[model samples]
Target chain A: MKISCVTTFLMCGNFDNTLAHNLFYVNMETPTQFISRIISNDRISEGFFELSLSWDPRAPVPMPGQFMTVRVGSLAVPLLRRPFAFAGFDADSSSAAIIYQKRGAGTELLAAARPGDELDVIGPLGTPFVIDTDQSKHVIIAGGIGLGPMLFLSSALKSRNIPARFIFGCRNKSLVPDTKMFTDADPQICTDDGSAGFRGTVADYINTNVSLDNSTTIYACGPSPMLTSVNKIAQSSGARCQVSLEAVMACGVGACMGCAVPVVGGGYARVCKEGPVFDGGEVLWERM
Target chain B: MGANVDLSVRIGNGTLANPVGVASGTFGYGGEYEGLVDFSDIGAIYTKAVTLEPRGGNAPPRLVETPSGILNSIGLANVGVEKFISDKLPYLRTLPCAVVVNVAGASEDEYRRVVERLESGCLDSVDTNGSGIFGYEVNVSCPNVHHGGLAFGTDPAQVERLTSSLRELTKRPLIIKLTPNVTDIAVVAKAAEAGGADAVSLINTLVGMVIDVKTRKPVLGAKTGGLSGPAVRPVGVALTCKARRAVSIPIIGMGGISCADDALQYILAGASAVQIGTANFVNPKTAGLVSSGIREYCIGNGISSLKEICGVAVD
Candidate 1:
């Protein structure tokens, strides 16, 4: 624990001074850590799984783009908790879900999580995506497992009667999440191998199909390369963009400056604190 | 009768209410852990290392998850001494626990200036004398930094010289944070003691690295980082024990400590105090829980003070 990234360590300074930042997390009173029983842990597709857990209703309901760090195991072999954005949060059921791809030791352990088993969770943490008032043509894009938060955002947008051009990109048809929830989003599927809708990457689809304008707002989540591409596409179109980034975090809270992502400014930003979401132009893409 | 069991221990001229404290980098500036951890249960909160100027730290991929632990090359990225005074100190000043600013720098002058700025900068904001800035934890053992971190820590003369020089700037407490990547940890412990240090904190992270087989590249941007967590507990406990016999000054023990029992291992090995490090990432309330568990163990065993159990296992 003698480690420290001597950056602008957080308290009030991590998050930006935007209205959305204040609206969502301003009085996040009594951040609670709880143990929830796994309601279900089901594989939705090849190398992809969905975990649902009972929630402590006392804790604030997680907004779209918000994330939780789940303790996948009791022991230290898989040392740090895996931070996953909320794929779903149902206050009525008092449960939440995470859609994760089985990649590392942590998710591999999470894949084996069974119903009736208990897991520790700390959340509704980080800045949530804001529904801007200008009514810009909203475009929500998800790449592979990045679909988790974007899917949550789409449903929330629909409930608010906010329509968006939804796109989900993956390697092929087999990589797609096989869930009723995914189908509910009514997303345009783009596949690399032409096994689905539009052929090639999400960048290719944006370049060939969608015509963006200054009034456009791009909201995205996915791998770094895809996010970098989104940043570029939005930049060229002069569209405002808020990207949800995925970074490895030792401490899910702002405490550990381990989850740093390079921004346009001089110093690095802790992705766990300042964002899993940031302005497209704010990030220094070349460094990423 | 168990209610009267005392857990108070010494950290120099000042008394630590308990032996449970959070490590430097893991705890950040204490305010970062607002709603999650109860500050009342902790004995100390070692703030992140502060330098003369702000540090951008290493490149991305600063952290990598190793088995039972983590490897980090954060490179001491901090908001500099000026910002630490302006931004981080206010919240740290209000914490119920003791606040120890962990200081790091590339050169000896940078370290001196950082402490000097803190000594003078905290005057108007603080009401109680020297209460806002509790003490200093000189981070001579940080392995990730290319400059004065482990370099100063590994040499006995440099440790002694730096400790005594910084000793002149403050009277509160000077705890030299030591690294384990050395041939002899005791010589360094004795070096701090010889330099008029109030206490010594042992076993900063051991230098380690992780590689991605597919890419054939190092996982961390710095290529090598310090390893901490349960993986380093034995190394920490062993070093804590070694330093205890070498120096009479209080020994603050840390490394891979997650539980009260893990802390107890250090206390039995002669650590006057213990810190919860990587475990904070797993659970923020770990220090408080560890405190409670340690108290319960003391009461159940009919031990009057934690000092009785300190270093009991060594003989």
Candidate 2:
């Protein structure tokens, strides 16, 4: 049914506000959040930087594992918006935290954000990692900044008293955030170069410690290869798994067909609409 | 007055607020541009073309950014007629300005049904100037999908059949959108008028392609797509002029109109109004710019109202 009434207000000509009714307006009405200041902007790898942000609510609160559209340059040319998953959103009594990696113009601009600068953001869009109730144990697989979305998903799951295990993967130990939020969990970390943490891929960590039949559910967000590998293990082990799919999006809302993912059933579905989150089985991963 | 000219004109049964309306498919319904483009400033917002059924659209790689344009083969993926009426239409009613819904039909009956259904609402208004609710821009020129877009637009007789069929359903004005892929756009424009169309929009996305040299394959999953953006503006202007001479009814010109200057060129070339497509991808604020630019041009030229520029050309 249509909502009793729809209300609209234009913040300005530059900023975009998404309004929808019925299935179009899903959970988390105000999802995208922006940063108030930069906490750290140190470089991690050759071109990547491990950046942290203090969240501002005027910016919508990003759902765990959701991404935002960050504008990069002062130039009007090359005006398409890029999508990035939230690294984390752990709120304290006074503030919140988010992490991202510098990749392209959007990220480069995000990296240049100073100690007192603000960024235009739209958020908590797409289906977030579902915390499954059917399983008593949970496993997380992360790769690169794909680890970003997992951080917040982990925090949300842990606060609910859900027993969780994490497998963080990156090329070197320097890439992993200083400390995984759930310190008590002693989550597993893997580095391709053995520079730190477990000296192997996160998939290897899962292979050694996880038994699919252990009342387990898997939540994963990372590089496509890592997710594909994790998906295989989760499937064979009979564990229900949800994977976050990433795409280049124009409008975070379903208006633009720029960010579409192929489904197993037939036809294309919007990553911003049907889901950035999908059952491992429901997606035709190979086709995409 | 030498370099400036007013840019508004009459379209069907209504006088537009301006002459730079948002084109179908690009704007994705009016609300998409709510805060990005001032809803009340532009002439009208022609929503994304809606079909009888909700389409899932084509697979991955639907859009590609070219030098100054974008090649998109989105396939008109929308929420079906039922969802649009029950969900999309009500929100459109709330907009502060006129809202014209672009309709895409795969068959004659579907075309009639959509027009018949829309006419039942407040869309039946006639302003003091005589044109209101504006009208329906039957999108026969969309090249993105295979179903019905270019399917009917390419054949003049079929285009005539669809136009006349819709004209019979409602007296609320009908604008048939024509494709530029044809040998002669004016032939199709005349066919549309012969079928009783009140107006027509020229030059939907031009069929084009992009390639990934590394993989040695087409960039879009569909392999080929429609090219839009500044790349197609000249083609659109030429065709809009040709169609204007062939048909007595007003013509809505479109194809890569990103700025006010681009929009004005279409007006001077004989377009009653112009539609801005690919520009929305580059700047969501484009519609507002074109609208204000027209007004600014009008005031600078001592043009009292937008009506004077309807078909004023160099000749």
Supply candidate 1's per-residue lDDT for B223: 96
What is the lDDT, from 0 to 100, of the residue A256 in candidate 1?
79
Superposition error at A188 for model 1 (Å) = 0.7
Off by over 4 Å in 2: A1-42, A51-56, A74-77, A89-120, A132-135, A155-163, A170-187, A191-201, B1-8, B31-38, B117-134, B241-246, B309-313
DockQ of 2: 0.26
lDDT of 2 by residue, B1-315 (tens): 354554546665566656777788777766654444566666777877878788777767888767656778787888877788788877776666567778987787777787777777445454323133457889898787776789899999999999888887776657888889999988899999999988888888899989999999998888888887777888988888888788889888888787788888888888877887776655566788887787777777777665577567832
Look at candidate 1 and tell me the lDDT of residue B140.
98
Per-model fnat list: 0.91, 0.24
Tens-place lDDT digits, model 2, residues A1-288: 111111111111111223322213533354433434556666545455555556664544455656666555434334565666766554442234445666655577766667556655455566566556557778877787676677777766656566688877889856756543525336677899988888889888788866776378888887788888888888888888888888766666667777787778777777775678778888777776
For candidate 1, the per-residue lDDT at B203 reads: 85
Per-residue alpha-carbon lDDT of candidate 1 for residues B200-233, written as tens digits (9 for 90 to 100): 9988999999999999999999999999999999
Instruction: Give the DockQ-based CAPRI class for model 2.
Output: acceptable
